[model samples]
Target: MIAESLIQRKPPTKESAVLRDQLLRDLQGAASVSEPVARQLLERLTPHERWALLKYAGKGLRDWLLAAYRDAELSAAPGLEAAHYPELPEFLLDRLQDWEAKNRRRLEARIKNGHARAPETLRRMMVEPIALARFIADRGVDRWETMKMSDRIAFARTRPKFAQHKLKAFITFIEGGNPFQTRRGRPPKKAKKVIKEIRQIAVLTPDELKARLQDARQRLPADQYLIYWLVAKLGLTAKVAYGLTLDKITINAKGRVVIRPAEAWFAMPKSIAPTMEKLARNADAQWPYETPTDAAAIPVFAAVISERRVGPEIFRSETTLLRSSAIHAAMHYGQLDRKTLASISGVSLKTISDMEFLVPADIHSLVSHDLVAKRNRAILGSDDE
Candidate 1:
């Protein structure tokens, strides 16, 4: 009754009517909205208090949108705010707007300079500012440069260190130096060491590995099956596999097939060669189809349905498959010598060591290796877990 009375008190302006139409259109685009429009009594509904006239809806709609935003903030920082402030703080909002503008400018320059994935990388980075802003709002803290070093460290410790990297990158993009870099101090004298009888990584015996591969082949579609097969056989990291070109895999003068011949000259596994060849043949037929020699330039793995329209159709998630294989290989089959593994997989020694290709013990790999481990731990148990 109050909502209706307030809405009815003022005559709906023509601008409000147009804004309402835009709201309906945006709702249609969002995919989550499913409200049916009524022609009989259509009216403009503006939110009361704190919410903007732009993108305005009724009180309920405003609450819903604010609730969703707060939910996202909480996902990043579990206890950032006791309650959503009646209005978003001006400093936070203004800083975010400035950060977004800088992103746009930098994106344009990267595009002009021919950076291959400027759009995608910049788009992903845009989320970091919002996360940082929420951290500030939570503590009622502003002016980061002036914050106590201990307090900053405490806040940084609260957020996932992996996420903080992106935040650091965004800040460095504008500020020209990283504020979040931690300084080394004396180690704690009484730091505890763990003794583990159980292995954290799933290292399968040869029989188990074979059975798992066969099961994956049976369950996954043909395209993905081929990708998984290559990853398991070659021990290639996702970056190397996902970025493979036709020239990377070929028969040498000795009639032995070479995979990643430039770096490793590693022979392709005889068992998987026939399947890889078939996938290559199919891909050769479709892209640069007329020029078979150019098939190497095309992605070996791509989407069946085209979505990007203007760009390559490579399945970015194929990288996930490759990484997963590396992770599993680390547990069971990956090389213990980091240098040898790096040569074979084109994955670095740092990555191999970080992911515990040799040891999945208590000190480091137990807590975090990559974003996946951290999130998995969150789901598996608390931060301590």
Candidate 2:
């Protein structure tokens, strides 16, 4: 009964040696405090595990660690915490483990039902990180407050006309008001259909595309890079980009980016190939649920990083799988014909338009210049004015 209380997941390392030494000192009176027990635990569990045992089972020490070790030795990869994320509070991990175990069924169902966008919602926040909230607030961004739709669109880097349902779902999640929640909602857009075809998607200009790319390359990680790269650069939707298969993306003999037998080739950045390969290697960890061994045909952005790793069974959160600001970038920057973008991404023309943040050319041009002017002023003088 006491053994069940101190459920340490990892073994003890030098970092936890002090706790272990203290535990050993406290337990020297016990007959089971033998060298073999220490060795078995050291060889089996992690530094964290040792501390947990010391704290919990220290009073009523256990031979349970040895039995647990024997059981694990029977398995091939009994430990997958080798590739752990750093700086996560122990309490946060505890909550994650509990949630992972409890919500396994629900999570699997979500993956099945295609709930792959914005998996990082803080549904389990015990204590909000005041420092992080303060930092964003210091920059005049109050993460706690509900963001204006325009600001949300700007922040998402997508168009003003959002996929109403998807954005609404995301907003509902955010309106839960946790510090890590998105905390934004979609603003109403006038229901105007430009051409009744694909003219609804706002196209991005070349310069705007470059700027978006530069901003994205600097701000986003590999997975996010793929999302925007496909949407902003290649004109794919966030969902489409998130779910894009490697088989659907390839380079042809013509030295251009092409979707293969489905359509024509398009220009691609030189750096994309390497990133795709890296994404491939990490895909199993990120997209572990019912994933195929042959990952080449898998979704491009489906890997799970440790910070967001959800479970022993599923491995990562799919809730935050796909986020898109691409439509906004496309409409405001790429300015490609809506039909062309629709063709590239296979999203409905109307849906694309609805999700697009249609900034007029003059407004768009002015926004671009203002950013440049701000940058110049920061360098030459001051932006205080």
Candidate 3:
């Protein structure tokens, strides 16, 4: 038995060890590896892992691998082809294909609207002719119609390159109905549970606000701290705070800081209204100017403006400061309800509700009116009549 075992076993050798080490080095340097090196590496991988590696690799690495190993038997894995994603539910697939087709039609409309040619890169990608047409045909024109004319044209020119032909083929395969002619009934009113998950607002306690300010001052640079204070404390949006001119902010005779809005800044007052009021009051209390001085003498917003002459000058375009402050404020304390918070922030209520990507929080505190109305309506049922 011992003699038979010895005959069956193959001993590890120096040559095999060297080959294993070289293969690892090649894998480690996959990013910078040349096409030939990548092909050689792929040849060593098991058939199963080869496809996995190709799919998971970064775009550049994958391209290099493909260029290097194109000679390999691609047909070896018929299971991994694009056509093998399993037939989705007919209804679902039809819906998706309809959406794509409508999107394509809208793009064609934009092209007919006299938009300029697409960028060279987009043209090379074949986004202009093929993919967009299929997309419009499937998706319909609602979303595309809402976009600005210039933007619509841009979309028309660039969507074809990625998988235009493939998308067209998919649509053809599905026998999907025309997206434009498919009249959708009014969508069901969203359940409270669904809305709760999507829209949220948070209110910060005084202590929470203090902690956030402390963290901001400690963590952020000096210039950024000032901007943060203007947003988090005063409640200015980044654009408004950055657009502040020296002339807009002044200490009045009554020892109150006054912030007269600039034309550019006045157009939108969502984030700045709170901060603007707070900053004015604080400035007046902290540094009261008894008499009027030249507009240049006063500090415009918190940020420094380049020119002393100030009609509509930007203070500092440090948008990240506002974003970071808002994020920190939300994470530390919580988010506010959309409606109530929107009122406080001076943003449109509709805008708040529509924003889907925002972090979820209980918005009852922000939009108590809506909650109250909803509850009251539920209590007074239709059967009561």
Candidate 4:
């Protein structure tokens, strides 16, 4: 059995005294000791004793103990440290590894310069490049330089929106001039509509939509819930919500929240005003807006949510919420005119148009009846005729 005594003993034995002295000496020494060794040392003490040791320890020893305990706790739970980088699989070629290392260094430099704040963001950005490298290697095309624009487009067509985003970031780090044409593979608006319609189905009522959001709020973290709430209430897209910065948001004199997404400023929902104010205050305290180093570049949602990779699953949910909200807005407010709906929801005109088909049959009939009546009146004919 491990000794229950701490560094400070009730009746100090010579061995106990020697151990304490050795620990202190190691802590004060310039050379670093491994956390596993430190954790082994700590396990001998009881929980209360460990707390007591930490309380009396000097700042250096205390910090080391805290780190050791934290590491131990995280190790006990897999994925607790979300930003921990995984080792490349043995199947990956050395050339691919070198390219990944180069990209990683570029990402590290970005972090050092404050261009990117989160390590998980870098991880997400690396996904497509790593996947592409593996794909090419499997096909015996190990070097990325040999890939053509058509090859890149073929790979891109198979990817979803999240991977596409990562692919864009990955291309920027390529050594030579951009190998593939950046704008060549973009699908037209009509093709997008076909895809959108295929994905969307019957619309939910406003109440039903609100209920779903409430359920999500309970299940999701606070930061994620806030983003979804903004999308639901303000009709903002999740991508837009994710990119919000403190500089773009301000609390007005009358205690209303105003957000400037583009050239125009829009008032946010009153229910969320207090939360926005609190977030603004917290952000202001952490990174003063007046700093010359682009403190305003820090995204409010991204900063909070970037500890773990927000992959395709989250984006898929966001898309569902956005489409549902669009339909809800149409049903709740009886909004017509594609442009007006587009302005309100921050979605494209095409999305608004597609959502119109999902509106209740009663609403569609009313619109059809109105149009028919207007046409008859123009011809100077009665409804009976």
Identify the superior model by TM-score, candidate 1 or candidate 3: 1
Q: Residue by residue across 187-218, what tens digits does model 2's lDDT show? A: 67788977665334334455655775787678
**Candidate of highest lDDT:** 4
Question: In what order do the candidates fall by lDDT, top score first?
Answer: 4, 1, 2, 3
Rank all candidate structures by their TM-score, best first, as comma-separated numbers: 4, 1, 2, 3
Over the stretch 213-282, how does candidate 4's per-residue lDDT look in tens digits?
A: 7786777766666776666665666666777776677655665677655434567766666666566655
lDDT of 3 by residue, 259-333 (tens): 543211122234334455454433233222343222222233432322232222222343344434454354334
What lDDT would each prediction earn against the true structure? Answer: 0.48, 0.43, 0.42, 0.53
Clashes of each: 1, 36, 44, 0
Instruction: List candidate 1 stretches off by more than 4 Å.
Output: 1-119, 134-161, 169-202, 254-257, 286-296, 304-339, 351-385
Q: Which residue segments of model 2 deviate by more than 4 Å?
A: 1-212, 221-224, 255-267, 281-297, 304-337, 352-385
Give residue 159's lDDT in candidate 4 (0 to 100): 81
Residue 372, model 3: Cα distance from true site in angstroms: 14
TM-score of each: 0.44, 0.31, 0.27, 0.46
